[model samples]
Target: MEEIERIVSGKKGKIDVTPIATIFRNEIKEEVTKGQMKPRIVAFLTTDDAGAIEYAKWTKIACNRDGIEFILKKIERLDLEDAIIDANNDDEVHGIMVYYPVFGGMLDAYLQDVVSPAKDVEGMSTTNRFNLYHNIRFLDEKQTKKCVIPCTPLAMVKIIDHLGIYDKSLPMGEHLKGKNVTIVNRSEIVGRPLAAMLANDGAFVYSVDISGVICFQAGKRQGTIKMTETTVTRDEAIQKSDILILGVPSPKFKIDESLIPEGAVVINFAGCLNVEESVESKTILVPTIGKVTIAMLERNLLRLYQNQMQSRSTSSSSSSAQIDQPQQ
Candidate 1:
């Protein structure tokens, strides 16, 4: 852990992440009026898993440091109904997130209940999803944002955006946009949401299923930019892409020097636990910890905080107006 942190610290000069998160946070705080207002509450809905707890802690710190109040909803040995009700009734809680996955179809039902549309920071609410599909998902007219973009997908895009230098020599949206970028697994949190997010960004994304097409699309989209959920090392997959995003730490797939295109920019969002075979020295390898995890959590918290501020300002103004009206 120390070595990893040191490695990340060394790269700080090259990639400054502080400003990136600050910019995002300020964007959220901007929507509110400057004055006395009700305190904003955010709930960190999570499970007993250590990772989830750690993530919740990160979120709590970020929120508190920014003057946002937060609460934790841990579903350790608790029934889903009780958990959902507890989350819903917490008036101080402006957002709800479910960090743990439940067994059977019960998880879906619980998610729907725990996350109210207005407070769905992670955008898992059925109503918010409905609004998303209908194209009406935004707090303001010109905002042009989704109600809640999945954290991982948002993290991936932010990293890409921060990188700035996309090889534009290969055309813009149409070339990479909507091209069949294949995802290996189909988890709702990652694959489904990622596919939707990427597609919304104008990329033709395909969440790989057993029956999906395997033939590469000749030119660009056919064989470019593969972002995988799990490890699947196909020589054709490696030889054919311009950008590769790896999101899993499983040992199933390993990239060899021969597999990747020369000078390919690879993003290992899978964290440092799984390192593929070293390619040429020119291969640009990006680690996920400092890049994706923190960035994504920071971004989501910022968005959620912004939405909370907006809601508070509106509520305060409405209350003031009502109070000003003479009693009947």
Candidate 2:
């Protein structure tokens, strides 16, 4: 098998995210300084996943010097409802994030319960979802506008922007507009929101579940960019589009040399691939997507947090000033 192309790694070599991260950090710090705000406090509630713990740890570290605090708690009880209600009591905790795969159907409800609309950093709450769906208020005190957007989805958008793929000054959205972009999953966490985000920007987004993938053939080419959130759909989608975005790491899978479209860009967000068979002469497979995505998530979360804080402060000041002045 020939080597596959790795999009994230290749882009990393070309994309200097340090400047972006620095700018983001400075902006947030500036806001905190401007507001004379106290240190931020974060809380995590979720099942015990090493990845989740590590992510929370690093995020905490990043915010440490910047007057942001973080806390992590593993949910032993299956009752997330209680966890959320308890989260409300911690006035210092400005952000609430719930990790994935927490058993039962209570994840959403729990998130909704724990996260005040302003502090929904993960953007999983129903209120935030509704706000995003209606485009009611994209950025709050947060500059992003949308509340409760998934971290990954926001990272994808940021990555695209970093690459100058959709800068408003350049008539952005052509690459995705009306383009037949096919996503292979429908998980609310990823598929649904991302599809809506792309569609709202005018992309012709089509979701192909596991069953819809049976119809995929290696030889048939259809779209300009085919993105997959599951390993099962990567090879098929890679073979059909000029650009491919790969996420998920269920297990290693072989990538036949003939399975790639010539000159295609493949981004392996999974960071886990069968090296022996995945090697393609023309393909590039990135092994650091997991790390980069984590970074991206942290960056986005911070932005969302700052935005909320700023918005709240501005509103409070305005309300206070109005009250002091009385009727006009």
Candidate achieving the largest TM-score: 2
lDDT of each: 0.50, 0.49
How many backbone clashes are present in model 2? 22
Tens-place lDDT digits, model 2, residues 24-122: 556665666686665444554566667777767767766664445566676664665566555544445556666655654774565454556555666
Give all candidate RMSDs, comma-separated. Answer: 8.6, 8.5
TM-score of 1: 0.65
Q: Mind sharing the TM-score for model 2?
A: 0.66
Q: Candidate 1: where is the Cα deviation over 4 Å? A: 1-19, 26-47, 104-113, 129-146, 165-182, 202-206, 209-235, 249-257, 271-280, 289-328
lDDT of 1: 0.50
In the predicted model 1, the residue pairs found to clash are 178-203, 178-204, 217-222
Each prediction's TM-score versus the true structure: 0.65, 0.66
| Cα shift from native, residue 38, model 1 (Å) | 6.4
Clash count, one per candidate: 3, 22
